[model samples]
Target: MTDFRLVIVSAGVSDPSSTRLLADRATQRVSSLAEKRGHTVTTTVIDLRELLPELPAAMSSQLLGPRFTRAVDALVRADGLVVASPVYKAGLSGLFTSFFQVIDNDLLIGKPVILGATAGTARHALVVDEEMRALFAYLRTLPVPTSLFASTEDWTDKALGARIERAGRELVLLMESGFARAVRDESWDSYQHSYGSAGGTELDIDLSSDMMRLATGGSLRDSDDDPFDPRRA
Candidate 1:
């Protein structure tokens, strides 16, 4: 038996939309697969529509206020990730891109992700196949094959159900495969090297004794507030 967790995110702007369909199908696919493997599965859905948007600058470094930070924590610990979006202009939705761009550290790195998308016609279905896959690739997520996609025309049809079922089986194989490549088994800190990485070098990491990390609490350095543990000027 394995432990699996899935975070289905739909960064759709509309109130009643097909993006949720993509997310829901992905969730169902994972659920069915978990049953076959006897894996304990937990699911969390982050509907960007429901989340009040924080400033772009605040989340630009993977430190997404409180809500997204916790979401990151969960994704980092999960065995699986399935993310979907509504393609716009041959690419992912801007809302989804914003969510993706801000992450300094992709918590789901090395976890298997099922890339999915819903669009108006089959013409853009390939966007799901190409764009979302590349996005996950950039995040270093293991995007599984058999992407579950549906254009507006196919949602209610019987073939859609069959495709979803097929995707479910693929997801099962994905879970088994991802379990063997778990990143936690390796040192996470090693991945932190390289230019433009979060917080830069060790010197960039200011070790303040104050018990605050985010601007929401207070500024890291305030002329009025006494600063430092005396170890560094």
Candidate 2:
């Protein structure tokens, strides 16, 4: 059986939050679907509320502590992710956004992500599509076509369950197909646009160009025997 790791990030603040409930429902469905497809799935859930105290340090210092690091590492190593947040001010939670802000930009590139959101009313449902999707897009993650949004009333609605199953199925199919892995393996170098990438340099510059030559203090052709001698004017 294929081994898969799934990470669920729930940005719920309450003791028994609707956001976490929605995330749990999605994770259960995805796990079931993967099992049906002959894959063994392991899941890790990160509740951002628990890490709230460390967020300010992470954001300001741009460094993650051991606890926060472990959470981000789980996300980096995950084959798929279910990210859920509670909507505030008609958008995603600030805590949710801050948690992601400390992670490396390239960490989630080409990874499959299932976006979810919860709010008090259906009027805030579009936050999943507009806000959450845009955030994952910026990270270069492949968010499934079916996004899940749960309002307070949706907790008892059968249609919410159906949508959860649909979104879960899409995530499972993508994981089974190995689409994210293949893309990361084949085109990773092309996506490297900053330091510490596998490519060693940004892709936009040509190392052999005149600008690069000048930047590197000219070519290695001018070799003077005297160490103290300057170049002849």
Candidate 3:
């Protein structure tokens, strides 16, 4: 049986947080589904609350503490991710956005993600698609078609469970298809990547490119080859 690693990033601040509960439920569903398909799943959970102490430093100065470093390491190895955050002011938690903002942009490229959110009122149910989806899109993650959103009332509803199962199945199928790995292996160069990104695993640098040469104070491209050059104009 093949093995996969799943990382759950929970932005829950309370001891018994519904946000984390939603993520855990999704995790359970994913694990069960992967097992049914003859695959083994290993899970690593990164509780954002635990990174609060380092959050300010990370946000302001891009300083990664031990906890932040560990989170990044976990994500770098994750085959899939379940990211859940509590809704605040009709949007995702600041902690959730802040954590993702500080990480390397290339880290989650082409990775499959399951977006989830928990809120007290159903009025905020749209936050998952309206807000969370946009964030993951910007990160260039492949989010499942079904997203999970649980209000206090939704927790007891059977629909929530069904959605969790659907999202889990989609994630497993994507993993089995090796979409993320294929994208990274074959088409990574088609996407924008920064040096030392993706937890230092993204070491591919085109040192012979004109941009690299220009950055190193080398001679510019020939005026005939530069569309924007004043001489060409």
Top-lDDT candidate index: 3
Instruction: State the displacement of the C-alpha of residue 109, model 3, in Å, after optimal TM-score superposition.
Output: 0.7
Between candidates 1 and 2, which one is better according to lDDT? 2
lDDT of 3 by residue, 1-233 (tens): 77999999999999999999999999999999999989999999999999999998999898899999999999998899999999999999999999999999889988899999999899998999989999999999999999999989998889899999999999999878888889888998988877888887889779889887777765487878877766565
Model 1 poorest ten-residue lDDT run: 198-207
TM-score, model 3 to reference: 0.93
TM-score of each: 0.74, 0.85, 0.93
In model 3, where do residues sit more than 4 Å from their true spots?
A: 215-218, 223-233
lDDT of 1: 0.68
Backbone clash numbers for all candidates listed:
0, 0, 0
lDDT of 3 at 179: 82
Candidate of highest TM-score: 3
Task: Using lDDT as the measure, name the better of candidate 1 and candidate 3.
Answer: 3
